[model samples]
Target: MQTSKVEIEVDTQRIMGTLASPDTGVPGVLFLHGWAGSQERDLQRAREISALGSVCLTFDMRGHAETLSQQRYVTRGDNLNDALAAYDALAAHPSIDPNSIGVIGSSYGGYLAAILTSLRPVRWLALRVPALYRDADWDVPKFSLDRKDLAEYRSSIVSANDNKALDVSRRFRGDVLIVSSENDDLVPHAAIASYRSAFINARSLTSRIISGADHALSTPESQKAYDSLLLGWFREMILGAR
Candidate 1:
């Protein structure tokens, strides 16, 4: 196994990531950390996933980590572009097999991953407490969005046609795994149900909720459970595909 640092240039800002590669001609997995989270959160998991005969890339999105200064100025559009760039870079890696790609995201990252499926080729997708946002503020700074309205929007039932992320979920034909926290205050049950209803076309769909877990999986037990669930799903989706 080879682990190394990588830089992805997104316009003027440079995004950083940790890449774990086993060998040549293997599948690739991209890990997108949530808003206010950094790539370090996914590094260990990326390494473990790579151990399963695949290459894994975990990157820090704009407005986080080294780019913390941009937190107040970054928009969803900017982060989406970062995700695209990271995906492209992983696909172009000499050790990766472009035809077999998987993406795993959490919260804000999950939202971005859903949209990415519509724009890229993803054979497998795993989302952890995927979030939903109103399309009215596509260009506004993420931090500036109204929390009250956003909270209300998430609590209400939304159909696939009415939400960008859910809309892509409806069209996605690949394997999907959605992990939700049972006690997540931020992502209500209504939001999860909306996503469940939207994946009408997914090749296969699996949903799991960690008992007594919160949005962050703050407890050690919850964290372990999440890791196990994700790795098991990857074993089925990634290794089984081989």
Candidate 2:
């Protein structure tokens, strides 16, 4: 496998990443990590996919890694832009097939990936413990806000995330896999339900709930299970016969 460190500039900001390729034209998979996560989390999976004769890209989102130190702004839209740029860069690679691109996102990254399908040509999507996208109050950081203040603020922070995710499912003619932690505490039931309902029009859809797992997959056993589920689904859905 051939690995390369890469940096892509989106507008004035730069997103750092890694690319691993077997120098094959089979397909390309992009890995999007959760909020506060770096590309290191996806490195092993990326290499495994690369060994399987596909190209893979794993990148740190804005307000993350090197980009975090270089910039002060971090928003969902900005992350989406970074993803778009990364997609373009990967697709442009000589060994990659532009039409055969897949994405795997976890938590906050999953939310961005959901929105990205509406904007890009993604053939397959895998979302792991996706964050609550439709609730702005849930996503944003609350430092010193009191209970009463938080409640009032939450009420006013209207979001179209549900609609956006639903639109992607309705519009994107691709395969989808959603892996959720059975004991997750951060994401609400409604949020997960919204994501499940949105896939009504997907060509293919698969879902799994990891037993005794929380949002982080804290235990080694749970972590192994999550990785296996994620990679196995990718093998079937995106890398079929490759």
Best by TM-score: 1
lDDT of 1 by residue, 1-242 (tens): 78989999887878998899887539999999998999998988988888888999999999999889999999999999999999999998987778799999999999999999999999999999999998888999999999999889999889988888899999999999999999999999898889989999999999999999999999999999999999999988876888
- Runs in model 2 lying further than 4 Å from the true structure: 70-72, 135-162, 239-242
lDDT of 2 at 205: 88
lDDT of the structure predicted as candidate 1: 0.92
RMSD vs true structure, all candidates = 0.9, 4.0
lDDT of 2 at 119: 79
lDDT of 1 at 168: 91
Per-residue accuracy of model 2 over 127-241 as CA lDDT, tens digit each: 8877644434433432222445433432332234435655666566788898888787665445566677778778898988899998888899888898888778777865574
Which residue pairs come into collision in candidate 2? none
